[model samples]
Target: MLLKKSLNIVMFLFILHFIIPTTTGYTHSTLEKTHPVDREKVTESPSTIELWFEDPVVLHADSITLLANNGSKIELNQTNVDAGDKTHIITSIPEELPSGKYKVNINVIALDGFVIQEKIGFEVIKEKATQKKEEKLKIVKYSPDDGEIVTGSPQKLNLWFNQPAEITAIGLFDNLQQPIFLSEPMVNTEDPNHIIVEIGEELSKGTYQVTWYAHPVGADINEPDILDVFYFAVDEFTPIQQLNKGEPTNPFWFKSAGLKQLGYWVVFIGISLLFGGTFLVSIIARQSDSKKWFRITSILLLVVIIGEAIILILQKQELENLSLRQFLSVKFVWIPILQIVLITFGLIYSKIRLFFFGVTLLLIPFITGHASYPRYGGYLTILVSALHLFAASIWIGGLFGLITLPKKEEMKEWLNDVIPKYSRWALISTTVLIATGIFMTYSYIPSFSTGSFVKSEWGKAILIKSVLTLMVIILGYLQRKTIKRLTSKAFSTIIRRSRVEMIYGLLILLFASLLVVSTPSAAEQGVYPISKQDQDRELNVNFSPLYPGLNVLTMEFGTKDIEKVEVTLSMPPNYNVTYNAFKVKDNVFKITGNLLHAAGTMAMQVKVIETNGEAEVFDYRIVIPGEMRLNE
Candidate 1:
């Protein structure tokens, strides 16, 4: 009883060691903010307001609005965030923002769900109208080159504005007057005035107009300038056609490709062993007396070498359309060929030297070139992968070979000898397999901790692979242990356990497929800004259908700019609404319309977008649980 208890403790410790090592240093969110600032104080009527952040913040021009002291909101239609400096500079601050104490309110959101609301109050002093408008105010250029051919499939449309115009007010329009959807235009930080717009995907052939409006910093809240428009065209051209017609059909043999490749390797290896075994039996049969096993083995080796050469030729042809010479050049092919040549000489001429020469030739390519780079984890990976392949070939290919061969005492003796040799190699191979697998997981996947593994797709996949690998290791151990206790009855047990090990190995291979498909962890994708503050002053809300649910929905008033924002849904009693709050980006909160479960058009109300615990109210109504959709 004591022994059994000790064994259980040992097993538990082993399991704990395996599980604990794989669960370290994981994080759920990859986003991180780089810069911190108390606030911004503006002194002059600067053309743009620049705020710096430690990491990149997603800037949506339509979502940004500047509020003046007179209770008026200035719309910043197009704002571009500088990619290089981690700064957001509003282009074209409203020219009419009259001298007054003004607050810059910004609602910024990052791609990874971080929201930021930044409020920087600056004083805009009144300037005398008598002072001639400074020539430093560069002219806004809005003309494309004359005679430039507009192609229907042009990759992008270029807009050159004179002087650096604050880019926050530029918008592109399609032929139908609808806004053309485009990702934020990238500006040359070195030349802050130059901006390039990249068209998304393919554009239809037609004329497109890009308009610019000016939103100067500290400008009067009521006044905004409408800048000139630029036009470009995509001329008619030959339509690109698909090379292949019809809906895509899956390859008929796709499912069988892996099985077919495996079968080919098995058959090729089996033939070599078959001829070798036959030759051995023939020599043994000829022996009238003495333990003539050695002579039979020697003959079998020669026959096997010849069979291997034939198999090599067939394998080469099956791989691709290659010249016989080129196929022979491949190291895997050449190794067998050299082995055959040397072994043939050894058998006919009684020259053991040739066998050694062949072995040397086989080791050449395995040691050089890209295969030996230490930074790539070097010789270790090669050794592990080779061992894995070899063990697989022996266990899978050898079994098939044994079942197909004719029964003979010499053949049986050879099989028994090879199995014992293979079992020892299998143990080493399994060790290498586990070690290399762990190295790869830690190297490629980030933080294997419980949090990361649960939150990230890549980590989850690696966790699954690790679990499967452990199962394979356990099965392999059982097989090895069963071999030590071998008896007449143990043969069936060993075979069954070996089969289980093979199945586990296959599962590991399947996990490999999934690992390749998953995205890299957050650390690899680089850091972005994330906000933790609950109240953000720069909350902005836009609802569709103008009115929602029966409740008097009021968009309460609050600061125009904030780092993060949250909205609370409030409704009169007897009405039920279910809502989901999503941080769309760094400073964007998308409070979805509530779904009313009750039968009546329930009156639902939401206070104004809240920033930093402050709120503004905007009231609207809709039929409860109506089919109306709201897009922000």
Candidate 2:
């Protein structure tokens, strides 16, 4: 039955995948290609600027501007959508441009509300323009001209222009190309045309880029805007004095996706056995003395659930680059705490009370999960999730209760009678589970059936999970059939099939848990910020690509006011420690050394101090990538 059903499922998915609409119309809405191409160097100036998008674009605010090497704009008289093609945005250049490096900047808002920005560089060589001595209103000179390297940190940046200009905003980007948190640009009041931006913080040795937009101070509102971009490098600055590839101090938790995944598996089983088992035994009476299952199993299961909750939270916090204090403030942390208490009571005192409490326990996942969002049907999704969770738990837990029951003459009579009844319960539970699963898929997955199942990781997982679930149902049905025969040989078959069914059930829970971490296909494309919950004054920290390499660290502090912050990172092979983080802006900081040199449960500590003497301390675990790579 299992093989037959699995094949049927495979066929269904085959049809689903092939007959589905390609994502070509939805996800591929970014740059197809750009005019002059990225990093192109040209000898001739193009008469018009153009941009091509992969999909139909709904235009919002759009800008296509040309800029000189210095911070000054060259007028492109008019810009509009190409009459012949909507995909291309065209801008008309006024006259032949002078010989100088120029940058083209384009910013377009897609119909889906996603902002796409692109910049390309090219040089024109036919004619040379007069120097600053001439009366052209434009930038004459600037430092860090196109990929120039700096020997040491520069004191300040200087911009000279033919016309006096007022600064608007200036931005600095790091190696990862994220803008450094910065204050607004400061212009020279004494020299209206010249702007002097102070380098408040000394930059670590690395390649960086600066981009800015400004306009002639008193020009008409319709005049073209000045946009400029340039690269600068801090020559050979290594924050760490030395390297020790010989040994790593931290353990696997420093970057442990494996640890988190393991936590998910354990939590699922614990929930199944504790709540599901409790619910099972509450109504199913013992006959000929209950199968001699150990009473200590409840205690062990309780420990597993509580411990997994802790491990899961820590893993989530680390992956998000957030400190524990910040995580504690999130509404999510409370669910686990309440679960620990209720599950503790349920396990210690096995009664019908536990069955009711188990139902309440389902709410924890509901609140913490993505379904709680209003867009996914909010409370409606929560109710459906509750039904889905409770039913599956009872079904799986009942099977576990049977499997663990001692195979003596004692349970023979009781097991035989209960098997048929439990089978009926399992049927109902599986129905609810599958139905809710479909609803959730539709809620989060756009054009779910119309699009290829492989289009998104979420889709692939859902597809695989559905197939596995169908196979589990097949096994469950076969086990139910065996129970009806009730012969000695048929009983043996029941055990075998139930064990297989249980395994698949656990696997289904795994798939569901993983889907929580995934961004649904319908949730718009590209990396969406991990939705965080904040219920109090909490300090939240996050780091990206939590790997053995350099990564960006960000922090959001609760109760903001006038203050300074300090952050540090320590890496050890064995007591060899070093601090490698520098302040970027306000609460944000970046790591500059071999931060995660170990593959064990490495912990990084963060400290926040206010202008006064008050301070808050937080520590987070980040396992180096060995078993699993997180922080992606």
Candidate 3:
């Protein structure tokens, strides 16, 4: 019993000590990616300028500006959010721009109510007067539109152009770059500018791409043909699946998270021992000596109070990117710090009042957690969370007190009485836990759809925690059955099962930690659009599932035996994350993670180091999708 209890306490403190410096921090909305890209050069003027962000941005009249090289503001159409992809804010150029360097400046409010300002610059190359005049020859419309996900295969491919154009060549391809048969292009009967081609065979359930070459009907033969490409999916399988190839994103939370969960676990266990032991002693086992256990519980509470202070300080420092001294100066930071100090004094000076007043301090986590900022039932959720915490502490702490009881012959009589009384309390606590758990789940999740529960990180965490809780309940049931027998053998069995139950309890706390950090599905409205692709003659880069969570990035270098590859990804002003890509096969390198912070736009820089120590750098700007409306 001594060894088992000591090990549990050591494990609790060990996790608390390590995670004190890295609890979940503040979440500020940020830019994800942008169109035109920063410092890009294009051969022709773009029809529209677009921006993507990790969170929704509030748009206004002066939200966007197009400034020429000499600081002249170019007129633009009224900016609006993209209906299909809420995270995208777009505005038209109205008229074609002349060849020059231009800057797009934007100022918008992020979801977290912070004003974000950013500038994207690109150069437009001058085209010949004749070529500019012939720009009307471009394709105006197409079937299975670019990046569209369709239900089934269509019979023929169609294209519409603003000007009469002769199709030179047409090709179709699947995700694997395998060619699909296409009939020779023929002109539509009603419109000379429209071209049509029959599909040689029915398409399968996968993403498909169409490439066509065309030129103006009455143009010079020496002029180059116009090349165009578009993609559509037969079903839901998108290009993101191609890049990831069914591999799960790197589990960052499992790798380096759960600090807060462990911190709370320690606090929960500490309070449970202090108060649960009191309940057991005063009500169930008044004649049994428990001073030694009470002493351990008092010392553990002191440690927990100190740990809470350290976690608060570290969390504030990381959230604002501030130094310890700078964080200390923040007035609001002191409120929690002072609260903790008073809780410590209460623990030391007055045990009776401490049981009531100091215990209330533990409820602070419930107040600051999801309850405080729920999407619905705000105050009701907070109250439910408090009840949930109170019940859980009693159940877990009471179990601990039972398992650590002295097992001498004289103590057997006391054990028999104590076990039955504690069992009743455990049953009541467990019932409250289940009811509150269901209420909180309904309070947080907007929808109960299978997709809503299975798709989001927040949903997954809740599911895992629920499963663990069920397991603990099963163990409790067995222990309850064994208590009715009340033999020495049954007592040993109950004690052993109780230890396993506590371990499960700890795991439940860990998933609870994950839930605290994960954004609820209702909150993350970012949509998965087409994969962002950038390539040159020598290198190709693909970033997929361009939302905030679980992303896969692939890089292919043409025929190079690369020694190493490193990528630095950033969203200007605030967010930056770097990862080293591992060679998946040959010259193809891959890195996957919850890399993109939010839905918007992101800039990525890749450095490829050759075997001879020579390095080549590549840059790309990509967009991610999020909720359309301004976040509350």
Worst 10 residues of 3 by lDDT: 522-531
* Best model number under lDDT: 3
Cα lDDT over the full model 2: 0.58
Query: Cα RMSDs of all predictions?
Result: 24.1, 23.3, 16.3
Q: How far is candidate 3 from the true structure (C-alpha RMSD, Å)?
A: 16.3
Model 2 CA deviation exceeding 4 Å by range: 1-258, 286-296, 299-303, 306-329, 356-360, 449-452, 522-632
Model 2 Cα lDDT, one tens digit per residue, 1-632: 55356447535533543343322112213364567765555567778877776443433322576889995988886667777877788777878877778888765544322234557778866543233323436667777543345678876778888778866778876665656656555667787777777776777778666778878778777867777655556773222223343543433111212334444555666766766665555556343223243364555456566545755555353324335664454344545566666666654455444654575457545544456655457678778877878888878888877676634664576556777777888898889988998887777543323232443445556777889988988788777767777876777678778777766776676666546544454222111222232223366566553444544455666554425444545432122232323434455444443345532235456666676768765655443333221111
Model 1, range 340-401, lDDT digits (tens) per residue?
Answer: 55544544443243333334333422421112223224467446534433434334333332
What TM-score quantifies how close candidate 2 is to the native fold?
0.44
Best by TM-score: 3
- Quick one: ranking by lDDT, best first? 3, 2, 1
Each prediction's Cα lDDT score? Answer: 0.41, 0.58, 0.65
Candidate 1 deviation (Cα RMSD): 24.1
C-alpha TM-scores of all predictions: 0.30, 0.44, 0.52
